[model samples]
Every structure is written in structure tokens, then in C-alpha cells.
Target: MLKAGEELDMRINELKKYDTITIDNLKEIIDTHLFLTNVFSDISGHNNRSLASKYLHFHVPNMFYIFDSRAIQGAKSYVMSDKQLRASLAPFGDKEYIELVIRLFTFQEHVKSQFGMTVTPRVIDSFLLNY
Candidate 1:
């Protein structure tokens, strides 16, 4: 527990250097999420991607996109059904968490252009959850 807290503290400090999420800083954001997931997974002996992402999202809501089975399925479904989205999305690679962030960023832009309203990560999560 002590080690886990220390690891989290260190990651939080690293994350504090970033003021916001942007295409330029996205790699660092994803690296932070992967680092936290590995840290907790090492301590807990379970896959911690979802938990790590949720925790990071709590601290940096605008920067980190929450990941879970439901949201993954929703994103997959939505992307598959939208022709323009399929063409626009970058090809997914081995890092699925990175793919999710890219998808969410693209989806956010799509929504803003289609509806003339900007949405946050939380709003995107809600849409995915209810999709």
C-alpha cells in the first residue's frame, strides 16, 4: 500500500507538469496512464488499466479518457457504423489505450462539428456507456 501510494504520487507529480491535453502532448498522457496501470498491476497482480484510467481521469478529467469494457465496445460499435469515422481514424496499433484516446479525440471533434457543441470526456463517456 505504501509503495502503491508512492508510485501514484510520483506519477501525479509528473502529470502536474501538463496543463492540458493536445495532440503534441498526447504521447506523454498515454505514457502516464500506461505507467500507472503497470504500477498498480504490479502491486495488485491484476490488470489495472481500467482502474488506473479511472483514477487518472478523476485527477485530470479533461486529459485522460476512462477505459473499460463497456466503453471499448461502444467505441468499436460507433466507429464501425460510421463511414466517415472509419476513414478518418488512425489505424489502431498494439497500444489499445492509445487508440481509445485517439478515437475519443476524433469523436469529440466529430460531435462538435456535427452538433455545434463541444463535449468533454465525461460527456463522451456517457454517450458511449449509453450507446
Candidate 2:
């Protein structure tokens, strides 16, 4: 536990160097998230992607999208229903959290184009959670 905490601290300090999340830096952010997720998964012997996302989201609420079962299911349902949205997102890879961030970015654009309302990660999260 102590070792994991120290590692998490070190990684988070590195992450703190980024002032904001943007397309240019998103890959690096996801790499950090994967690192944290793997650290927890190593300790718990189970996948911890959601927990890692939530932790990072808590620290940088505006930057990281909160990944939970409900949101993931909602994203699947939504994409399945909208061919355009599904087509807009690139094919998923082993790192699903990266795909989720890309989906959120595409969704943000979709909402703006369809409804003229600019949405944030938090708003998208609420929509997904409630969907």
C-alpha cells in the first residue's frame, strides 16, 4: 500500500505539469491514467480503469472524463443508435479509456452541431449516467 501510494504520488506530480487537457496532450494524459489504473489493478488483482478515471477526474474535474459502468453502457447504446456518431469515432484499441476520451470529444461536437449547446465533460457524464 505504501509503495503504491508513493508511485501514485510520483505519477500525479508528473501529471500536474499539464495545465489543461487538449487533443495534443490527451494521449499523454491517457498514458498517465493507464499507469495509475495498472498500479491499482496490480494491488487489487482486478481491473481498476474506472477507479483510476474517477480519481483523476476528481483531481482535474474539467479534464478527465469519469468512466463508470453506467456511462460506458450509455455510450454504447448511444453510439449504436447513431450511425454517424459511431462512424465518427475511430476503431477502439486495447486502451479503451483512450477511446472513451475520443468519444467524449466527438460527442461534444455532436451535441454542439445537433443542439447548438456547448457541453462539458461533466454535462456529458451526467447525460450518460442518466441515460
Candidate 3:
């Protein structure tokens, strides 16, 4: 849990920079701040994937996905099930997280190519959720 004002403001301000950051820059941010790894440190115990992803998605919607158990399950069966996905997810980090992001980006491009740009990340997420 973040503190009342200054801490929250700082976090929000920090997150704003991620909106246009590249994958490598994102990795550095994650490494430096432990954005996902140390999320919910105040109240929620330790590394919580759901909360982490939700927090990241709230800040960087176009780049991050809300990766909960359901999303992972759906992705395993419907999107990525290869050895690479397994290896990437087995030990989650900046590299693996960015890999997942790239996979989603690729899938979004494929969806756009197949069904036109009418499809958005939400649409793809809906499909993944239902799948």
C-alpha cells in the first residue's frame, strides 16, 4: 500500500514515464524500482502478480496486461504454450515480462491484420479471457 500523498504522487509520476518507454527501458525501470516484484509490499505480503499487473496495466495499458491466474491459464492454452513461454513464465522478471508483452503485441498485430484495426487490446483480452 502506498502512503497518502507524496508517495502516491511519486509513484504515479514515475509510472507516467513508462507510457512511451521501450522494452529495454522498461526492464531497467522494473529492475530499479521492482515495480512488479515488490508491488503491494506494504499490505499485500510480497510479489503479487495480479496486483502487480493490475497496477502496471492501469499506468501502461498499451504495453502491460493484467496477468492474473485466469489470464495465464488462458494464455497457456489459447495463446502461448511453447517451451519459450514456459521458460519465460517459470521465473518471472523484466525479461520474461517483456517477452510476454511482446507476445501480446504480436498477437494484437496478427489480430489487426486478420480482422482489421477495429480490434483493440481490450478485444484481444476479452478473447483471451473467453478462450
Candidate 4:
């Protein structure tokens, strides 16, 4: 697990391996996310978070999160549609909405520490759309 205030640079490097990203990568992201409903609810799975490598595959590499209405609000300025909002979440099964808020807030903290900007999820989604 990530420690409080751990450096995100190294983590970013690791995440890049699976980052075959593009504006059109949403299709892949959507497909990947759609699998979560069955996967997360399963009692057992090889790619589950009980394993370190598997956990990273789910979170770090995919850069995906469960749903949060607040995150949708934060992403409002970036994506204009509910569709785009839905797309960003296309990677996780149903999760406690607060977890999204916490995870996203942590991401915002990482960005502020590294780049000195307090970006909302909207800014993040905008970047990902073009990234």
C-alpha cells in the first residue's frame, strides 16, 4: 500500500508500461471496466488485490476508480457529458462512493505536491481524454 505522502513519480513510471493510452483508448477502458462487476464480487480470483502485483494491475496500471458523484462534479469542467463521466468510471465494480472521493482527493494531493496545481477530476479527465 502507498504510504502517506509517498512520492508518486516512481509509481507513474510503473504505470506507464500499461499506458497505451489515447483519446480513443476509452473503448478499451470501457471494456476493462465492465469486467469489474463480476470480478470484484467474486470470492476468489488470481488477479485480486490480495496480491501486490495483481492489486497494481487493478489500480495503478489501469488508473481507474469506482463511481463518485462528487468526482463527476469535479470532472464537470472537463467533460461535458454524463457519457464521459460514465466512461471515466469504466474500470471498477460498485464501490463506496466515499472511496472515490478519498482516492481522487489523494490523487489531487499528489498532483499538487508534484505540479503545484490543485486540479479537479475534470482537469484529470480532460488530460486523460487527450493523453
Error of 4 at 22 (Å): 1.5
Reference-based TM-score, model 4: 0.34
Question: Candidate 3: where are CA atoms >4 Å away?
Answer: 1-36, 81-99
Identify the leading candidate in terms of lDDT: 1
Against the true structure, whose TM-score is highest? 1
What TM-score goes with each of the models?
Answer: 0.73, 0.70, 0.56, 0.34
Question: What is candidate 4's lDDT per residue for 76-128, written digit by digit as tens?
Answer: 44333334444464454233332333345455556777899766444654554
lDDT string, candidate 1, 11-89, tens digits: 6777677655555666667777877777777878987888888998898777787898888887776653434433333
lDDT of all predictions:
0.72, 0.70, 0.53, 0.42
Query: After best superposition, candidate 1 residue 80: deviation in angstroms?
Result: 6.2
Runs with alpha carbons beyond 4 Å of true place in candidate 2: 1-20, 80-94, 112-118
Error of 3 at 86 (Å): 11
Candidate 1 clashing pairs, residues 3+ apart or interchain: none
Question: Across residues 38-73, which tens digit of lDDT does each residue of candidate 2 receive?
Answer: 777788898888888889788766667888778778
Candidates sorted by TM-score, best first: 1, 2, 3, 4
How many clashing pairs per prediction, in order?
Answer: 0, 0, 0, 4
